[model samples]
Target: MDKLRRVLSGQEENEERGLTSQVLDASSLSYSTRVKWFFICFVAGILLSILGTALLFIPGGGFKLFAVFYTLGNLAALGSTCFLMGPLKQLKRMFEPTRLIATIVMLLCFVLTLCAVFWWDKKPLAILFCVLQFLAMTWYSISYIPFARDAVMKCFTTCLS
Candidate 1:
C-alpha cells in the first residue's frame, strides 16, 4: 500500500538512503534494465573466457593472454551479479560466513594468476592458479543453491568410497 502510493506519487519515502542506494536510484535503472545489463555482461564474460581458452593453443605469449582474459572474464561475470543485487548487498552476501572462504580463495586466485603470468613469468603456475580459480568459483556459485555443497560433498565421498 505505502509502496504503491510512493510509486504512484513519484516520490521516495523519507527514509535514509545510503550513498550507493542513492546513486543507483538516481540512475533510474528499472528492474528490466538491470536484468538486461546483467545478461549482457555475463554473456560477454563467457565469451571472453572461451576466447582465452582458445588462445591457449597459440604459441608465444599464449599463456599470458589466457591468464589475462580469463581473469577479466571471471571478474566481469562476478560483477554482473551486482546488477541483480546492488553492489553493497552483493558484496555483503559474498563475504557472508557461508561463502567467505570460497570468495577469498577465488579472489586470491585471480591476483595470483595475474602475478604468476606477468611478474613471475611462470606459465605453469599461472595455469595452476587459473584451475584453482575455476574450482573456487564453482564452489562459490554452488553455495547459492540450497544443499548444493552438501550434495557435491556426498557425491565426491561416494565416488571415493
Candidate 2:
C-alpha cells in the first residue's frame, strides 16, 4: 500500500497521486467489518447456487422463482464486481450504503435459489447454473482479497494501540 501511496505520491512518476489505489483503500467499511460479511454472503451464494442447480435435476425444478433467483443473483454479482473498478484511497467513510445495497441483492438471489431448489426436474441445467453462480461467488471472495490486504495495512499504520 505504501508502494501504492508512494507511487501515487509521484515518487515513481514525479506527478500527482492516482485515484485507483486511493479508492481501493477507502472502502466504506473497514476490512475487518466486511471480511466476515463478504465470506458469509459469498459462501451462502455458492451454496444456494449449488442447491438451485441440484434442484433443477429434481423434475419440476425450473420454476420462474428459481430461475429469477439464479439469473438475478449472478447479474448482481457482475454488478458488484464493478465496485472493484473504482479508485483506491482512504475515504474516511461514515455509513456504508453499498453494503445495504449488496445485502438487498444477495437476499433477492437467496429467494431465487429457494425456488430452484424446490424443483423436481432439470438436473443438467441446474448444475450448469450452479457452476456459474459459484464462479461469481468465488470471484467476489478472491478479487476482494487484495483490497482487503490494503485496508488491513491502512488500519495498522493509522490505528493507535
Counting clashing residue pairs in each candidate, in order, gives: 0, 26
Report every candidate's CA lDDT. 0.92, 0.48
Best by TM-score: 1
Q: Give the clashing pairs for model 1.
A: none
For candidate 1, the TM-score is 0.86
Per-residue lDDT of candidate 1, residues 104-159 (tens digit)? 99999999999999999998899999999999999999999999999999999999
Cα lDDT for residue 103, model 1? 99
Cα deviation at 34, candidate 1, in Å, is: 1.4
Q: TM-score per candidate, in order?
A: 0.86, 0.33
Which tens-of-lDDT digit does each residue in 22-122 have in candidate 2? 66456556555555555555455556545544554455534544565555555444443333332121111111353334334444444444444456344
Cα shift from native, residue 25, model 1 (Å):
2.2
Off by over 4 Å in 2: 1-27, 61-66, 72-161
Model 2: lDDT to the true structure: 0.48
lDDT of 1 at 129: 98
